[model samples]
Target: MTRKKGPKIVVIGGGTGLPVILKELHQRNAEITAIVTVADDGGSSGIIRDYVNVVPPGDIRNVMVALSDIAPEFKDIFQYRFRSQDKFLAGHAIGNLIIAALSEMRGGIDPAIRELSEMLQVEGHVYPASAQPLVLHAKFTDGTLLAGEAEITAAHKDIKEVWVGNNPWSENKKPHAVPEALQAIEEADEIILGPGSLFTSILPNLMIEDIGRAVLKAKAEIVYICNIMTQKGETINFTDAEHVRTLNRHLGQNFVDTVLVNTEIVPESYMDFNRYDEVSKQVVHDFKGLREQGARVISDNFLLLRDGGAFHDGQKVVDELMNVCSNPIKKRD
Candidate 1:
């Protein structure tokens, strides 16, 4: 007798939330493909990108560790951050440097990631959304514009729209997804977005011209795992429905077929502002608004607090995603 195959899941996003989802999905034996954002221009990733002229490796490193079935010591070495007094190596993760080196060795980010994935015993394919380094640009509701993912998030202004490009201030030379990234989406059984920053982590991938088009045209069910808490500069007062609306506004259509929302409440005093400064408050519920967006909302107690920070329970999210894959909603013509 032949064994049944697992669902093909393509997850799009970056930052901390993405790894959580990927690790859970890896354990479930799904055919996983992670399309990571290359628009990051801050922290260790930015430093490495500037020095080596490569895609930011911070998100990709985390995703690699998440899906890796390698030994614990090896994983630790990949994630190890240097604390040396030397300025060049200080504050950079070894894995970021390794990725930068490999990117140069292989002549491009896509090939570098492929080589790294094999060496790290990665359980799934990891593709950079674009081959080159990208910068994120945003137009605020007040008609103000900002460049760079870090700058845009730090502005604390209401964002009207966001896009990706080779240059920060100009939209010329629009970014395009690598062939592998596009093909993964086309072949996936389910595509999951978010559990990360709305404008920065998640939207940056979709902001790419051809990648956005591919997602809109893909036959699989596109599901969004809504953020558990409102982010300060990004989605300060955004309701659950507004989150979906923002995505649709960027993509030019209501393409998200399903949304997984956290129904559990966080006590007012439970939040530690100093520790979790980026988080604003618990996202308010608006089932009516979500339904208005034509999304089949699956609300549940998906919240998990660790060290006073709120996050999605990886298991719960994977369970919900599995259900969505098993009983997909009929596709729209």
Candidate 2:
């Protein structure tokens, strides 16, 4: 008996969400490409970018750790954060500093990431949307402008619009879109968007013109893993349909073909830990609204951290993704 090869998949997102999905896909023996957002401006990544002048490496680091074949000890080393009263070593990870050093020595981010990937023995390729450092700019509903990932995340303002900086950093240099990324999209049977923070994690990558164009032109099934709960400041009152609507607003109406939502009820105790009662309660499945936007909703036991709080069931999410890839449904025009 022979085993069939798994489908190729390109996952576009940043932060914890992309890594979670990537880890699951790797377990399934799927060919994976993670297109990570490089606009991060917080914590260890921020320190490296501000002082060393490099692409924020936090998201990339997360992806590497998620897809790595190394033992837990190595993984722990990659994720270790240093704390000190001294400003120099405070709040920075050894990995972030290493990536910064590599970026400096290699004279570019692509080669630096490649070097790290080799050391980590990662299972899949990870690429930033662009090589240069980019900023995320958001216009509030009141016309106030918020710039940078940190500011936008902390603004506590309703966003009216969002786009990447149009400065020289975002200029014509192609950032050498990873060959693996483009190839994955071109050959992919399916693409998964997220179960991550919508504005900061997911959309930031899509905001890159080249990446968005690739997603638009790719001849593959696109699936969106909706967030289990609304993010505090970023997505205050967004529902499942609203998440899809916002994605369409950015990626285009036809960019996403399916949405996997969590339908399993979570225990009330879990909700307390998640502080669900304090924030927007639940993101109800708006089947009608989703269908209206030409996206099908696949509801299941996607809540993993369920006590009362919702989360993506990693295994179930991967299962649904595999099923969709194996039997793709044609999109309506």
- The lowest-lDDT stretch of 10 consecutive residues in candidate 1 is 167-176
Best-fitting candidate, scored by lDDT: 1
Candidate 1 error regions (>4 Å): 1-5, 84-86, 168-172
lDDT of 2 by residue, 1-333 (tens): 112456778888887667777888878968777888777888888777877778898988888888899899989988888777757788888788888999999998899988888888887777877677777789888889988888887877887667775334455544334555676677777888987878888887777776777888878899999887677667778878888899898866557889998887666555764454424556767888888988878888777774455667688889889988877885322
What's the lDDT for candidate 2?
A: 0.78
lDDT of 1 by residue, 10-107 (tens): 99999999999999998895888999999899999998888788889999999999999889999999999988786878899999999999989988
TM-scores, all models, native as reference: 0.95, 0.90
TM-score of 1: 0.95
The best candidate by TM-score is 1
Every candidate's lDDT = 0.90, 0.78
